[model samples]
Target: MKIILKVLLYIVLGILALCISEMLFFFILIHSNNTEKGNKTVIMKTDSIAHSKALVVYQPSLMTDSTKNVAYDLAKGLNSKGYDVTIAYPGKYLSTDLSTYKVVVFGSPIYIGQTSSVLNDYIKSVNNLKDQKILLFVTGGADDSEQLNSLEKLFTNAEIPMKISFKYNDKGNENKAFNLGSEIGKE
Candidate 1:
């Protein structure tokens, strides 16, 4: 009986240690700043002289490039559809002026069922979003309804025409993101 009790205690302790480590990792990931040089803003201008402008803002993940790739593909799609797309990371230097943009898209990677605080803060800092055409997308292991609902709540005053989720391992996510941008440009 004594040996069995000891084994059970050890198992419980092992699980507790794992949970603590996981929580620590998540905290660090959430607070860590990404200073990658490639994360600078990129503008994709359409060939046509008459083109509407669009902005794609996203918070890139430190662990993966999937979110960044999706943002670029989305911008490319908008560019192909006669929209001048500006792709930027959420930061202090990012322009908050949305007056010139016909449409705006925001994206972030969902980690442990939560989106990045940086992206959320940037969105909140912008004013007069009620009249803007906003679209949202999240990349994660699965489509989390709770996370999507939470993101939607941030834009309560605005009309979000589309909300999409792309899995990290999904092969066609870039194409899907691009297609979404194209669809938005058509409107």
Candidate 2:
């Protein structure tokens, strides 16, 4: 009976050690991911909006809602400049004809170093965009050079108004969005 008890105790100790090690590993991984975000050098440009009608079509991050994203700030900035901006999530059924807008802004969150598939599909579906002015922006935790290159290649005729990658919990990027809007509005 004593031998059985000793074995049971040893088993319990071993299980406890395994659990502790797993927990430590998970904690370390989480810490490292939070501490190390890759290079975040996102570059963008904006052209003046000659017409008042503007549409901001965007896809929110998987982890964040539309209100807490750079797209929302970009729309707010455009609105502040009196561009008659309409912000819509690309997943929704929109009654507005995208081609009618004088300046169309496309925003997306970079996932796995690329733009989400939904945004890509939405862009492809839009028609009559050859003459319309286009603006593009992306949000991500790190510099998404691959995503930018892919998007630039895809939207060969579109102008990249601004490219910004904001880290988690960053609130200071609104000014950049506002400035981009102002630059567009000025023209």
Candidate 3:
């Protein structure tokens, strides 16, 4: 009986150590610098000169390309609707002057049920978006309703007409994001 108790105690201690390590790792990741390595902006403009303008700002995830793919797909959809779309990464280089845009979209990847600080900081820095047609998107492993709610709360100052959560493994996520962008561009 004593030997069994010792084995159980060791197992519990091991689990506790693992949980602590995971938490530490998460903290480090969240606080680390997240500068995107590639091109900061991708423009998708229509042929017409009278096309409306749309902006998509997103923080790409290091673990997966899901967020970046969704942003590009969304831009493509907006471009199809005759809107000049500019897809950008959230950073110092991105211009916050959104006066010329008819529509603005912000996207982030959910990690441990929270959006990245880079996106949150960028959103806070931009001003005068109360009347803008703002759309939001988040990519994660699951569609957690609580996370969506929190994301909405983060953008409470803006008029978010549409907000969506895309699961990483979902096959139809790209199409869904594109459709959402197309719908928003029509407005």
lDDT of 2 by residue, 1-187 (tens): 9999999999999999999998987565434322313222221223435436677777655455532356666666666666677776665365335766667777776545667565666676676566566777776778766676676566644555545455555677777777776677566
Each model's TM-score, in the order given? 0.83, 0.64, 0.81
Best by TM-score: 1
Instruction: Give the per-residue lDDT digits (tens) of candidate 1, residues 1-187.
Output: 9999999999999999999999999877766533322357789989988899989998887778888889998898889899999988886677666778888998888887888777777777666676667888888888666777788788745777788888886889888988988888887
Better of 1 and 2 by lDDT: 1
Candidate ranking under lDDT, highest first, comes to 1, 3, 2
If both were scored by TM-score, which would come out higher, candidate 1 or candidate 2? 1
What residue runs in model 3 are displaced by over 4 Å at the alpha carbon?
1-39
Candidate 2 residue pairs that clash: 45-161
TM-score of 2: 0.64
User: Which 10 consecutive residues of model 2 have the lowest summed lDDT?
Assistant: 36-45
For candidate 1, the per-residue lDDT at 90 reads 83
Residues 1-76, model 3: lDDT tens digits? 9999999999999999999999998876565424443448889979867799999998888677888899998998
lDDT of each: 0.82, 0.62, 0.81
What's the lDDT for candidate 2?
0.62
